[model samples]
Every structure is written in C-alpha cells, then in structure tokens.
Target: MLLPSRPAPVLALALLLPPLAAAAQTPMTATEFEAYATGKTLTYAQGGTIFGTEQYLPNRRVRWAFTAQECQEGHWYEADSQICFVYESESDPQCWAFWQEGGRLKARFAGDPDGTELTEVEQSKTPLACAGPDVGV
Candidate 1:
C-alpha cells in the first residue's frame, strides 16, 4: 500500500539564479518596498544568527536595533534604483538590494564584497522595543 505524505516538502530550489545569489532576480521598486515594509517589524537573520530588527513606519521612517547595541533612528530613500538608509549614528548610507521571495522579503548588501545576506525570518505588527536614546517610535 502506498502511504500518502503528511506535510508537503518545500524544495529549496532556485531557477536560473543570477550571479548575485539570494537576489530575487528582479529587485523590488521603492513603491513596492514601501508597501511591503510599512507597518511591520521585520526580523532578519544571517548565517543562522539573529542579526537585528527594524520596525518600518510611515514616511520611510525606520527604527533599527542591533542585538548587542542600542537602537538608532533612520530613514530610507530610493537612489539609483536601490534602497538606502541613513541613520543618526552614521553618515554613510547603508544600501541594500531587496526582493520578494516566497511572499517574504529578502535583502542583500549592495555594492559590497562581504556577500552579506539577510533573510526575513519573522515579522509582526508589534513595534520594536527601543531604549537608551532620543529616538522616536
């Protein structure tokens, strides 16, 4: 007798992936990115380690909290078809290449040789718990 499987297995597969691995081939636009990120707090992980969390707010406002440090307030903007963020603590803009994968957002560090990639592990409506500075919610 052939027994049916319970939960269907999700194959880890990518079709004709580009040189920039982890990218969704087509990068997300500013409008699409804003629409997908707003009102959600997203948890990102890299190399199986919980990196940090960022809460997206209206007007492209963002509150980022590293796991080992205090939170920083930042705002993201679109430049050259890439999403870049400038935080109060840093002058250099941290840019990223974003894409949608399986209904979830994934990001790759843009214009860097580090090959640092982050996957959206979790998301919620709850805001990030920020402390230690004059950062807005």
Candidate 2:
C-alpha cells in the first residue's frame, strides 16, 4: 500500500511565511500607543547611541530632551496612521510610526521603515527632569 504524500506547494509556502511575517511589523494604533506610553518615560537610541528621552504625560502631552539638554514641551496626535507631534519650540509637526517589539517601542521617522529608526532602550514611570528657565544666572 502507498501512503498519501503531503502537498509540496503548501508546505513550501508555509515554510516561507515565518520569516516574512516576522519582518512585517505592524504599526501600533493611536489607542494602543497611548495606552502603552502614557505616564512613562522612554529612552531611545539610534545606531546604538543614545538619542533622546521622552516623558509621556496625560492628554497626549509630552516632554522631550536630548542627552543632557533642556526639555521641550509637546503634544501628539494621530494623523494618517502616524503619530505627529508639535513642540512648543517648533510649530512644524514631526511625525513617526511606532511599533512594539521585544516589549519596547520602536519608532521610524515619517513612517519610513528603511530610514532612521529609534529603539527604546529604557522605560520608567519617573517624570523627566526639566530645569527651570535661566539656569546658572
């Protein structure tokens, strides 16, 4: 008696899917992002070097500071499936696509997957430290 053979094409397709699925990361929706980031401070790195840190506050407000720099106040909103931020220092909106991977947030500028990518290095519940205006006066 001859045994039935498995579908070769189906098997091949299944084998090819795992890597593709893993590579295709889905961007988080606005609700998911807010729930994950609110009341948290996240530090991001680019090219394995520290880039900046952001503290997420209620009502979509945020505070961002570069390494050892003064903080800037901003607010974020969802636009065209991307998170767009407007800072008090700059009126132009800076947009990014955010996703969760490895239990941390990953962001790409302008939703460009091949462009600059920032990886979250640390997360905390502590608020960001912002020095008062005119320090060392």
Candidate 3:
C-alpha cells in the first residue's frame, strides 16, 4: 500500500498569497506621478536605437521628442486635441499613447511590431524652467 499525499494545503496557500500582498500596497502621490511622467527617454533597442525624449509641459501634460521622419515639427502635440500627441503610420494615423502603471512610465507605438513597454531608465527630479505664460504645479 502507498502513503497518502499532503500537497493540497500547500497548493491552496500558494494560490492565495500574492493577492493578499498586493492589496496591502498604498497608492502613489501627485509628486510621485509627475516624477514618473517626465522620467526619461523611451527607446527601442532591437533594430537600431531609436530615442524619444519626454518632458512635462507647464500645463502638467507630457511632450515627447520630435523628428523629421517619425515625429514631425518638434511640437508633437496639437492645441485642438487638448494635449494628445499623434503617431503617424503609412496605413493610417496612429494615436501616440502613454500612461503610468505600478509607478512606472509606459509607451506604445501603433501599427508597430512592439507593444507597450516599461522604461528601464531611472527618473530624475531636477526642476525645469518654464518658458511661457503657463503655471507650474
């Protein structure tokens, strides 16, 4: 005769542990939000290194790097969209997107091979000078 196994309790404990740990964490602050927002240049390193610099505007919105090919005009955003940047593609106009998750900045390129990815670079908190009439937070 074979001995009975006791693995059911161990399996149940493993399944229930992570969710309990996650629920104990606190939400991030506004200052923390801004720091993560203007963190660093998001890059694609697979093919050739394509760099995109990001900065917080005076209006609390974010701006990204502009290039002649991928990004045009260096202005990036249009006034009518209220701050959303447009991503251009050969097939159709793609929406340039960004958001914060788990206190990190994430970006995505539309119609591109890669999906949204977390930036590996650390964010710095050095204050930037305001250029126009807009106010700071």
- The models' CA-based lDDT, in order, is 0.74, 0.76, 0.35
Error at 108, model 1, angstroms: 0.8
Arranged by lDDT with the best first, the candidates are: 2, 1, 3
Error of 3 at 13 (Å): 34
Q: Which stretches of candidate 1 lie above 4 Å from their native place? A: 1-24, 133-137
Give the range of the ten consecutive residues with the poorest summed lDDT in model 3.
1-10
**TM-score on alpha carbons, each prediction:** 0.79, 0.78, 0.34
Candidate 1 per-residue lDDT, tens place, 1-137, comes to 00012312212222233555654368889999999999999988765567788999999999998765677888999987778998887778888878888888777667455445677889999999877756563
lDDT per residue as tens, model 3, 1-137: 00012211223333544555423433334444445554433432212233334455443444343222222212233232222343222223333334455655443333333232223243444432223333453
lDDT score, candidate 2: 0.76
Candidate 2 lDDT tens digits, 1-137: 00012211223333544556434889888999999999999998766677788999999999998777778898999999888888887767878878998898987677333345678999999998877568878
Q: Which candidate has the top score in lDDT?
A: 2
What lDDT score is found at residue 8 in candidate 1? 20
Minimum summed lDDT over a 10-residue window in model 2 is located at: 1-10
- RMSD per model, one decimal: 11.4, 14.5, 17.1
